[model samples]
Target chain A: MQGMSPIVKNMTRLVAGFIVLFGVYIVLYGHMTPGGGFAGGVILAGGLALVVLAFGEEFARKALTHEAAKTADSIGAMLFLLIALLGYAGGVFFTNLLPVGEVGKLFSAGIIAPCNIAIGIKVGAGLFGVFVALAVFRRAGAGSSTGMIEG
Target chain B: MDPVLLLLLVLLGFMLAGSLIAVETRDLLSSVICVGAVGFGTSLVFLLLGAPDLALTQVVVEILVLVVLVRVVITRRDETHATSRATLPVGLVLLALGVMAAIVFGTLATGEDEGLTMRPFGDPLLNEQAEASVMAPAGEKAPEGAPARMPKSAGGAFLAHGLSESQGSRGTGAANYVMGILLDYRAYDTLGEATVVFVAVLGVYAVLRKVGRSRHAGNESDR
Candidate 1:
């Protein structure tokens, strides 16, 4: 796929970093914030998507390949499940093992913060991978022969 | 006659109109934009109703959906024949809306038994006295089989104890009760939901692999 207009590219460059940073902020402070892992992860995916749309598919593949995204997705899921299974040490399936620190602090909310990070990573990577895969693969496959508009 | 209710109704009407326009519009691009309008309206309603988390999710998801849909439409030319029963979908949508409306009204309707009906929007059903007993500290577990000293409803209990320094055998210590509920109280549900996302992405990659697409060219259009 071809890159978008210079106007769009410039705008994306200006805005993408903030989007990613905000997403990370939301994920990290999910226990205290209104938006949590899922929402922040989607925002992260949107940031990556903005970059991809502005720069084109080849750029996306180079910066973050399908393999990398898949790996991140797997790691996130595994990390979340591992956090849950580790609760076995507490004699329950999903017990909160870590000490629930003082309220209103960043380190408070045992298992929640880490779980948020894991979920954020999984959701962001998975959605980005899907978007890249669906859009990029089709463009590469049906070039010229399909007689369709290749925009 | 409350102003907040009036505002909520206005937003709901706006969303309904946008969705109707989206469904009725013949042009795909207009339809997509109208759907986005509806989504934005829903997000606004969520914000108005005091659920910022839902509002955040709705807004970002709506944008992503709009981007994906527009990308798909602009990339590919329309080649499929128009459906014969076009109004059938419109009819089904209206029917579903009617059913949903009925369910909403029915759930809100106050019957002979007060326990059955859903409480009004602003006026919650939590007993004021439940607040006094929810101050138990960490390492203290409620006795087995006995009702935990909490508010009547499950959600009420979470609201009372979710942010508390101690929450049954362990201290949840969550500033955001919603986070406590999602991650600590209902972690299994979150796990299943994550798994669903993982599988969906996997399915998309598997179906759209380079080798399979190259081998069976034009097979995509068949679907």
Candidate 2:
């Protein structure tokens, strides 16, 4: 696919970065704010989807390669599990292993922040990968009659 | 009712109308757009209900779903011949709708004293705890004008300790109660949820691309 008109491309250029930034902000501040890993990760994926829609599949693959996304997806899930396992040093599983300081500050929430980051990475990369797999795998113009729609 | 409740009802009505249109529309693109409108309407309801996190997530998710649905419907024409509407599904749906409406209105009509009352929203037990804590006896070292002291608490995160006036000292220490519950008190549940998502994405990847069994000998050549 050649993507949409120049208007869409320009608009995506201006807006997509902010959307990603906002997602990061939400993920990082998850402990202190309303949004956490799940919501912020979805936002990040949505931003990438916007980029892909405006700039075509090739640009999206370049922006976040299929291989890299797959790797990130695995790493995020493993990191989260590793964090949980680290809690074994304490009495129980999923314990707050890191020392928690006074709340409302960035560094005070102990392992929660790290867990949020891990989940964010996993979800964002996994969803973007899902989008790419779904939309871009088919050969261009071959979708009319011999499409994967019935597949 | 209050102005907020009235506004919420109106917004809900709009959302219901949008969903009906989405379901009834013949054109695929218009149906998808109507679905988007209903989703945005639900997002607005979330915002009005003082849940900004849900609103934010809903808005972004709605956008992504809209993008995906619109792109697929637009690019891939559905060549399958349209069949006549089956009566069984229509009857079943209407039956389900009728039962749900009856249950909802019945519960609403039930007084506040009854079980399953809709009046109490979000952690009804916590509400009771809050009410009980208001009459709490002061601790031994209580200072004058100190806020309501909480009783001795159990292991759960909802027991927001009333010991100190400090912001972070609230039980579980994290500022947001939802975060505290999600990460500190019930972190394992979060882990389980993450696992579900992980497995689901993996399933999608596997299902979307299948040439041969993945682990079969010499299957690497498919790449």
TM accuracy, model 1: 0.82
Error in Å for residue A136 of model 1: 0.4
Q: Name the runs in model 1 displaced over 4 angstroms.
A: A143-151, B79-81, B84-152, B162-165, B168-170, B217-223
Q: Which consecutive 10 residues in model 2 chain B have the weakest lDDT in total?
A: B120-129
**Looking at every candidate separately, what fraction of the true A–B Cα contacts under 8 Å does it contain?**
0.82, 0.56
* Model 2: per-residue Cα lDDT over B89-183, one tens digit each: 87889999999787657534635676655642222232343333443345534323444433333421234333445322354567776777788
Q: Best lDDT goes to which candidate?
A: 1
> Candidate 1, residue A119: CA error in Å?
0.5
Pick out the ten consecutive residues of candidate 2 chain A with the lowest summed lDDT: A140-149
Clashes of 1: 0
Poorest lDDT segment (10 consecutive residues) of candidate 1 chain B: B128-137
Residue-by-residue lDDT tens digits, candidate 2, A35-150: 98888998999998888888887886676667788899999999999999999999889888686777788876778889999999999998888887778755332523333333
- TM-score of chain B, candidates 1 onward in order: 0.70, 0.67
Relative to the true structure, how large is the alpha-carbon lDDT of every model?
A: 0.80, 0.75
* Index of the highest-TM-score prediction: 1
